[model samples]
Target: MTAFLLRKLGWAAATMLTVSILVYLALEVNVDDVAAKVLGQFSTGEQREAWLLANGYRDPLVLRYGRWLVAFLSGDWGLSSHFRAPVIEIIPARLGASLLLGACALLVMVPTALLLGVIAGMRPNSVMDRVVSVFAILSTSVPDFASAVLLSAIFVFWLGVLPGTSTMLTGFSLSELVLPVAVLALYSTGYLARITRTAMAEVMASHYVRTARLKGAGTFRIVFRHALRNALIVPATVVMMQVPWLLSGVIVVEVFFAYKGFGSLLYDAALNSDIYLIEACAMVSVVVVVLSQILSDLAYVWLNPRISLSGAERSAGVTDA
Candidate 1:
């Protein structure tokens, strides 16, 4: 397990480094002059040149990349052109909001999906199963923005149950997050439900489940202990994969709700051509994705003993011996 963890950590580090370089390069390509972007178009040629030279933007691409890399390593993410603040400072505040929203979405999505899916899987061809299947399909098929709009219209406009906008004044609170969280959760629930249902159905039909049933095990024991554990293995992986998707894909939802999360920050940075801010957002996103994948891989190994065993262990006749 120690060796496995180390390997995963090493891969995550490599992925983060590669993603950072790519993000930096991508951000660099979008801007003609970072200093000009900061100073505005009204600045004269000499003024622009001086600003560029002073900020080291006039240096070669490699040199600039190297300098940026060193600063990033030392925890200085540079200044945001749009916000007129340090990238490091601005990112965390936004990230906190995003994290809260994401957590709330996950909290709602997991149980709802699991319950619906398990019921569908257990019943197979019942009316409840069909209803769940149709709902799952619709949930996964509809785009997030459309869902957000529809939800906002229904809940905020007509019902007045939840707030339309996610703009919080002093500090973060649950009320401020409700709409955004619901939007993301509702959109994601369908995918998770379908995956869980499929996994559970497969587990229910397995030989071990048949054996457990034949042994006269109680229905709850057979389903929960024998079946659900195996079924959850795959769904858990799918759930973990959603982390990166939530981090980046929430941009449209955030924009619609006027939520100032990482996704919104990223969208603003891109629209304003704030390369440093964009790069920071992209790098942070990449880190989140890589770490989530690592967690997924570890969970996979934990669920499947065959995967947990070392290659040498499998090759040797250890089990036979």
Candidate 2:
């Protein structure tokens, strides 16, 4: 367990380093006249040159990246070119909003999806299964923006029950979150449900389930106690994999709703060419992806300890060989 965790963490760190380098290079190569943009368009040549030197843009690419990486590790994410504030200082509130929305959406998504999926899976090819499949397909097919618009029109314009925009609310409220959460949940719920249904259906069909039934186990006992545990591995991983998708999707949802979450913040930074802000956001996103995957792996091991135990035994055998 210790070795496995250490290895995963090491790989995650390496992945982050690689991602940071690529993000930096991509932004640097694509963005033209960055120093001038940071300084101002009308700034004099000397001022631009001075700013570049001061910020180490004049340094070699490797040196600049190294410095940036070191500084990022040291909790200095640099100043936001657009906001003129440190990137670290700017992220928390926006991150909080994004997390709030994401959490609420997941809370709504997971159990509902799993229950629907279990029902469908247990009765594959039945009317309930077909209906669940259709709903999942329809939900996945709709783009986030279109869904946001449709939802806003219905709930906000037609019914006038929910707020149209989630912009700049001083504090959190479930009423304010209803539209955005629904939109986000709608997209992810479909994918998660489909995966869960497939996994659960396969588990239900397996020999052990038949054996349990032959042993006089009740339908509920076999489905819940036997099938559900093994079925969870794939669906859990699928849910974890959605972290990046959810993060990216939030940009459109938040922008459409005028929500000032991290996604909206990212959109603003990209629009204004806020290089430091972009870098910080990208780094944080990569970190989230890494951590989520690690957690997912741990969950899998917890669900099926034999997997990790076998893995460790294999490692030991290889070491001995």
**Top candidate (lDDT):** 2
lDDT of 1 by residue, 1-321 (tens): 788678768878888888877877766643356656777777888887787778777678888888889999899988888999999999988998889889889999999999888878876788988888899888878888888888889988999988888888666667768778877998679888888888888888889988998999987998888888778877777788889889866898889888888999999998997878988888888888878777776666677666543542232223213
The lDDT of each candidate is 0.81, 0.86
Taking every candidate in turn, the Cα RMSD to the unseen true structure, in Å, is 4.6, 4.0
Clashes of each: 0, 0
Could you tell me how far off, in angstroms, the CA of residue 255 lies in candidate 2 after the best superposition?
Answer: 0.5
Which segments of candidate 1 are over 4 A away from where they belong? Answer: 29-32, 309-321
| lDDT at residue 9 of model 2 (Cα atoms) | 90
Q: List TM-scores for all candidates, in order.
A: 0.91, 0.93
Candidate 2 per-residue lDDT over residues 1-321, each given as its tens digit: 788788889979999999999998977653238776677788888888887777778778888788888998999998898898999999998998899889999999999899999899997999989998999999999999999989989999999999988885667676888999999999888878888899989999999999999999999999889999999877777787778888999999999989899999999999998888999999999998888877767776777777764463353334224
Tell how far residue 291 is off in model 1, in angstroms: 0.5
The residue ranges of model 2 lying beyond 4 angstroms of the native Cα positions read: 29-32, 309-321
Q: What shift in Å separates residue 18 of candidate 1 from its native position after superposition? A: 2.0
lDDT of 2: 0.86
